[model samples]
Target: MASQPIKSDGGSSSYYLIPNGARDLLDLIEHKRMEFGIGNIFKACYRLGEKDGTSKRYDLNKIIFFAQRELARLPKDA
Candidate 1:
């Protein structure tokens, strides 16, 4: 919605901007009881496709990296 300003207050970044109806990253993290690369993936998604100093490409790259890490950490069938 771009209604809230970017506030870096303390631990939770609940004030970060997102689409009006979109699910918040904090909600996802809490619901998922996130462990390992999930948090980083959420972090990257939180700011993805925004004009926050870093471009959307940067966030995409971060998401890709975190996803790759998570995928790698999972058990693989032989």
Candidate 2:
């Protein structure tokens, strides 16, 4: 399935995609990181897992790793 696009306040050009069931976790991490800082990504994941029962099954570290890797691949201008 095609990945879903994530909206960012930065601009239309600043966006990312989340594939599979990791969308919510990634979205929460991205939003929290932008609002708080990179240090909060793991905290956000833990909080989301506690609040959202379905998120517990996902491997937060793996998701963050892959997401960051994919985001890094985007053009610097993007």
Candidate 3:
């Protein structure tokens, strides 16, 4: 039988396909540092920073990561 991917209740899919013979210590390092603390519902807008080292008004928009509901379906109340 073929192996199936695992689906989490959070609506995300994950799978482990590494071979048993693989050996690489550096592979353990996180690519983007495991995200925690704040959730993924936030956006990263890069605008001109003030001289006082503070983020200025949002002059641009970029969706680093959007909410699942926003990506999945329309708002029910709308």
Best by TM-score: 1
Candidate 3 lDDT for residue 46? 20
Q: Candidate 1 overall Cα lDDT vs. reference?
A: 0.70
Error of 1 at 8 (Å): 37
- All candidates: TM-score: 0.55, 0.28, 0.16
Q: Residues 1-78, candidate 2, lDDT per residue (tens digit)?
A: 115666567855434544345555556465434433343455545575665554654547545765686578779997
Order the candidate numbers by lDDT, best to worst: 1, 2, 3
Task: Quickly count the clashes in candidate 1.
Answer: 0
**Model 3 over residues 3-73: C-alpha lDDT tens digits?**
45456686544434433554542232132232321122222332234224444433122232343435455
Once fitted onto the true fold, the runs of candidate 3 whose alpha carbons sit more than 4 angstroms away are 1-43, 46-73
C-alpha lDDT score of every prediction, in listed order:
0.70, 0.54, 0.34
Q: How accurate is candidate 2 locally (lDDT)?
A: 0.54
Off by over 4 Å in 1: 1-24
Residue 1 Cα positional deviation in candidate 1, in Å, after optimal superposition: 28
- Indicate which candidate wins on lDDT: 1
